[model samples]
Target: MIEFRRNIVAGTAVLVVAAVSGCAPGTGDRAQPATTATGTSMVTSPTAVPGTLVYLDVAAGRPITMTTVTDGAARRTTFGTATRSDEHVLVPSPDATRLAAVESPDPDSVAPGDLVVISAGGARHTVATKVMWGGGSAPVWMPDGQHVIAAVGGQWRVIDVANGAATPYPAGPRPGADGGYLTWSTNGHWRAIGGSTDVTVTAADGTGEVKRSVASLPECREAAGCPTSVQAVSDDGRYVALGHMNSDPSRVTEAHLVLDMRTGGLVNLPPTAPGGSVDRVFFRPDGGMVVRTVTNDGRYTFVLLRADGSTLATLPDTTQQHPSGRNLVTYRP
Candidate 1:
């Protein structure tokens, strides 16, 4: 029997209120303008543009919520429950109508875990694979919403929604290596995997085309300042965000690098060391902006930025309620 322990933070009661109110120390009252820790004010979007943003909330345990931000308000919609002890919710389609999520019933459970799907209205479907146990990782949905790609066991497999069948795809070498972190191109034509060596991109349909590769420090596990064991690919698939850190892991920062997949050119974005390293990078529906999270002592602060690496605004941390749960983000353009 494998039990997963959720870490709960103590003290800092005032910090909790400040986080939820989107006011981080010295930011004055909630009615005042939002600012970063450096006291830089941010512009708040008055209304959530209709069909413009999808907010990911892993506040709930097994069941997660996907909220649509429009007209400046949040409308949360409940998705299907997960089967994996450690699961991640993914939205790969551009229309925000389909979702892919990984599910492992037990930590010690073996092979053939499940890849579940949820339609826009929340219809559930499970795609079973031969990759048994080892636990499934993040799922990337294809643009058509009929297929999804995930790393099961040590191999990456693409599952078809119509038949709930999975086909193995070349996930770049190592069998047990952590190719778990994956993201789909906004068009859903390509999928990128981050693991032992460089980040590798491939076609989602098993077309066997090597799109491009962006090398990171060899041996990610052994890298000196690599803060994160996970990485995220932008929705457009033109950028990859890597979390850098010191030896302690607690002291971390983010390195956002824009990848010109067509030319194999990599440009590093301005470093944003927001207390903790950026845990996740998500593209807004407009494709012109992104949202990232930085965490410290189990607390998270969300930042909205432009593709050019400009800080737009900072969203209040909502992870206080579910300190142990992963924060999910999505957009509904």
Candidate 2:
């Protein structure tokens, strides 16, 4: 249920993106021109933000698509068609060329399933395992990109994607001081663990010592059983993001919380106007952040943020109807 990121020494506050009513300057509410192209379009003119935005349409069983932005133009490339669903939690490899998916055949039950590894050319290799759900439970691709670390039936195992081989991984999913699973930085140098009350950021070295612990927002602390997950970690390890993932239309919970690891400051991110919650957060290699927000009606918007958590631009609506934008899973910068 908790969400996922990595480490830094000396902490400050956090950063998150939200759609505020009375949007003020530096509130990070600035919206960019939307990208409306849909279907199997090979290329688009450009997106407001420059980077590769990947979307997996699990409902359609379409190939995984990657939209790369350079200068201004945006071009898309697709991997081979593979069986994916909302029941699957997809995590890209460290090199961004492959993906590790936790696939559950039954959508209603959180049971164990096959760990599908999709190669750059779209070939899939399935490794049977009990890895269920996303966040910390999603398979973690090690720095080598060949082996993945996943928690299997309470014990952690290092899985080999090439063949269905696995070995014990004692240094398993490192939990934060508050017991939440740790999310690591892009470089694997930093790891962050967040909970309902506080978030702890630490270096990834053998020390495993708590370097900085910052308080969560008042809203998070007030809500009972307020779920928290270390979603994204800035590559520089200075900022960490905590978010909630509520797809149900009835529940409009707190959107997100961002902590500045250097200063321990928190960005004020309220929920969207129409029962929208921050579903996911991805940090660009340049320190920028991409936030995925979902509304009560099942609409999704991808927003780009500066290093300081200020709004930079927004992508097109990634609803289920759009073939190209459907199931906006994650982004790679």
Best candidate, TM-score:
2
Q: Tell me the deviation in Å of residue 63 in model 1.
A: 4.7
Question: Mind giving the per-residue lDDT tens digits that candidate 1 earns over 1-333?
Answer: 001000111221111011212222112221222343211222444222223455554432456566655535656666655433323334435555556554444434433456666665557677754333231244556566677666665666767878877777544432234334455555454455544344554444433333444345342456453322224444334345544432220112233444433344443333445565545454442333444445555555555653234555566544322444434344443
Q: What's the distance in Å from true for residue 281, model 1?
A: 2.5
Global lDDT of each model?
0.44, 0.53
TM-score of each: 0.57, 0.62
Candidate 2 lDDT over 1-333, as tens digits, reads: 001111222342223322222221122322332245323111233354455554444434666664444323555656666453432466667666777876667544555667888776777778756665443355767657788877666566778888878887634235422124446666665566554455665555423333344344455455343434566665545566765522221111122666655455554442464677776667665445667676777666667665444566767453333323544444445
Lowest-sum lDDT 10-residue window in model 1: 1-10
**Count of backbone collisions within predicted model 1:** 16
